[model samples]
Target: MTSMSFADAARICLTAKYATFSGRARRAEYWWFSVVYMIAAVVVAGICLAAGSVLPGILLLLFIVPMLSVSVRRLHDTGRSGWRMLIALIPVAGPILYLVGMTVDSVPATNEYGPSPKAVGQPVG
Candidate 1:
């Protein structure tokens, strides 16, 4: 899809955010929800391995999409191309660059990744 509605974005997160890599994501949409997903993943992982459990492991497997979505969205917010996320291939610099990139805001108006998501508040094309 070229653009995602608020509801569509949410459903995407729950479904395949972690599976495939495509499209651009807005920062706000990706990061805020990511915080929630991370906490849940950690808790679920712990619970699943807690001696008498396997459910947490299953949940972790299912949780992959959301994790990926947030990361991609974080990249979008930084004003960098989402494909730039591959910078992580480097090793140390990869994650550092990602962290810094995530912290940065969108480049004011727009860059190569289409128009500003903010500008499309009225209706997206």
Candidate 2:
């Protein structure tokens, strides 16, 4: 696989890995994708508000799975189970903990999820 830049990783997450819940995502990949996701949400909401129609909501729905899947994979990269994503349900602490999880660096070596994405020649799984 070709080496991926931050932009490429974000694009891949939105396209190729749209609903890929299994596998690992590098911190860079997850963060970059998140930035794009937020931007898209803002844009879509603006369009929906301006148009005064529910149609644009469909676009947001389309992204739901990809967002969740990438979040799960990001947790997996930290050697955590996808189910752990449920922590986001708690009032304040949950979101804070989840943010910490996403911000931390990946394990230097492979855990149960797979090889380290930082490994040379290891494609982002």
TM-score, cand. 2 vs. native:
0.89
As for candidate 1, its clashing pairs are 17-65, 18-65
- Clashing residue pairs for model 2: none
For candidate 2, lDDT tens digit of each residue in 1-125? 34556688667787899999887888878887788788889999999999998798788887788788889988998999999898889999999988988888888788998887788887654
Candidate 2 scores a C-alpha RMSD against the true structure in Å of 2.1
Q: Candidate 2 — number of clashing residue pairs?
A: 0
lDDT of each: 0.61, 0.83
Estimated TM-score per prediction?
0.63, 0.89
- What is the lDDT for 20 in model 1? 43
Best by TM-score: 2
Q: List residue ranges in candidate 2 displaced over 4 A.
A: 1-6
Which candidate has the highest lDDT of all? Answer: 2
